[model samples]
Target: MIFSRKIPLYEFFPKEFVDIHSHLLPGIDDGAKSMEESLDLIQGLIQMGFTRLITTPHIYGSVWPNTPEIIRSKAILLQEEIQSRKLPVSLSFAAEYMLDEKFMQYLDTSSLLTIKNKYVLIEFPNFQAPLQLHEILFRLNSMGYEPILAHPERYTYFENVINNIEELKEIGCLFQLNLLSLAKHYGTNVYETAIKLLKAGVIDFVGTDVHRKYHLDTLKKITSKKHLKLLETPFKNNFNLW
Candidate 1:
């Protein structure tokens, strides 16, 4: 099939962009290490034409183990820093939750950070999806939260199981493809998968998932017209629908 659907994309990045996923928070998870580095990364994203950012640090129970209070405190500090520097960007914080057994505690308490409205960003294990993945998503839905599966293309286990991805949406899960995946930053398989999802129009949103300047560098180098065209739909939907 010839891909004829198009969203208005600019010569560079679209101005209507609101990067819903990133790891710009310093000393948090595997993202930026220090406050200075965080500011620098945010600045680079701003230069790329992103007007707003919802930086999502990992909230794995065993690893990052971040709490909502801790995330909010850091966000307040970062917002002050941005103001001090007058970055002219809207900054917010949310957690990229690992959807696992440990996550039940949060669900039990109904304590979770939202990206917008009832939407929450979640990441599944790359090795294999949980046996009860659908049930978990159902639980989230029952709690009045919608899950946006972060970087679905990077999940190698389901590379050949395209219908499994469709099943995710059947219950409740929107797919968020990483922008770097299109640049082959994750690998060729991820790039191919991202393209497949884009062509299928299965990807609902896109993000830099910018862990470092290297990510920004790769994104900046995505100057090919074909590549940029593939990005237009996600960008437009993220800005308008979200």
Candidate 2:
């Protein structure tokens, strides 16, 4: 199906829309607290017309301690539930890995999860970026893993240092913006940065980054033509992931 740019935000989603990042996996991170909440959130996304979701649970260190095996197991359980209900949705799983020592260990030793074959979804600390952020990205590129940096606009450090963001783009890092950031859900700074990134045509993709119902609720309010116009440039490759 073809999507026209004139669609309103609330009705923006259609069956072809594939959300590449979300935290609907139950009990895995700071996302949905239980299976019930997870299913509810999935249902809400379906209601909003999202038929395909790559629900990414946090794989932070011992805080969440989610390994690939654990994520696969949990993902299977959720898929089964969705099937039992006969919901018209396609659920898949990857992970939003935090850039830290633990992530490096995974990168060095184990098979890290991917949004697709070689595309990994990653996030930086909200407070600051890792000291060896460039080195880490270089290593990923060398190893043939395409790192999709999630929600680049939400990071406080990048808010004032636009050069850092540009350098990332120059070095082959793909940027994913949180949809809520466009609605000022994070803050004015994030909203402005998201707009700037989109307007600059630096953002490669967009996702819900939804941790709870509040996020989904806020996403529904993104009705401005300006915002929708900006979003038109992104998520263009989301369907290709399938």
Candidate 3:
């Protein structure tokens, strides 16, 4: 026997939800390719009832190499366009830093950009755990930045050692789940892990991590009741800090 049910994502995804993760900056990374596309994505988010957006473009050293100046400059240009068009949404910029050697150098010599001057969104390699993961989180905390580990459910390294997530939380690391993962956009394993984390109450925040229109479309197709209920938690989404 086989059975299935579907629920519209919009039914559970609050229109007022504050989105703190996205890549709508044009020509910066692997997200929007041009100004027009960026505007289109922003407008789409507005139509979806999102009141605020903190678009975080990737700051991978070898691939993206985006500095705070570069990101803010592009954001300023985008902001001007949004104003001229009178879009009814608030937008801001932060960077998703890859925990790599280059980032360590930045930690030593430069000030890292953060979300709302408090939270820092960070990521690791999908397939392997970094050698100095604990040290990095400790340093981030010592520097007064709340480190939010982006998409912990997507990391295969944690598949066999899921308990490590609790260890991370004990040490002040917050987990930001990718909204698409709940919708099964990545795969069954990711979707299952997302649900597990949600059930465990380890998910602190959720984000679109949207790179294009299709990502938004996939989110709209999500029909999981459990995923909707998980959103009810006090996810620092609308926190005044952002």
Tens-digit lDDT track of model 3 for 97-215: 99988988989988888888889999997668778999999999999999998999889778553598999999999888888897789899999988888888888888889999999
Clashes of 3: 0
Taking the tens digit of each residue's C-alpha lDDT, what string does model 2 give over 1-242? 99865544858654489899999888989999898999999999988889999989999988889988988998899999999999889999999999999898998798888887888999988788988999999999999999999999888877454677789978879888898897789899888888888888888888999999988888887875777677776756777766
lDDT of 1 by residue, 34-100 (tens): 9999999988888778878988899997889888888898889999999999998999878899988
Per-residue error for 83 in candidate 2, Å, reads 0.4
Per-residue error at 192 for model 3, in Å? 0.3
Worst 10 residues of 2 by lDDT: 6-15
lDDT order of candidates, best first? 2, 3, 1
Residue 64 error, candidate 3, Å: 0.6
lDDT of each: 0.83, 0.86, 0.85
Model 1 pairs whose backbones collide: none
When summed lDDT is taken over every stretch of 10 residues in candidate 1, the lowest stretch is: 4-13
* Per-prediction TM-score: 0.92, 0.94, 0.93
Candidate 1 accuracy as TM-score: 0.92
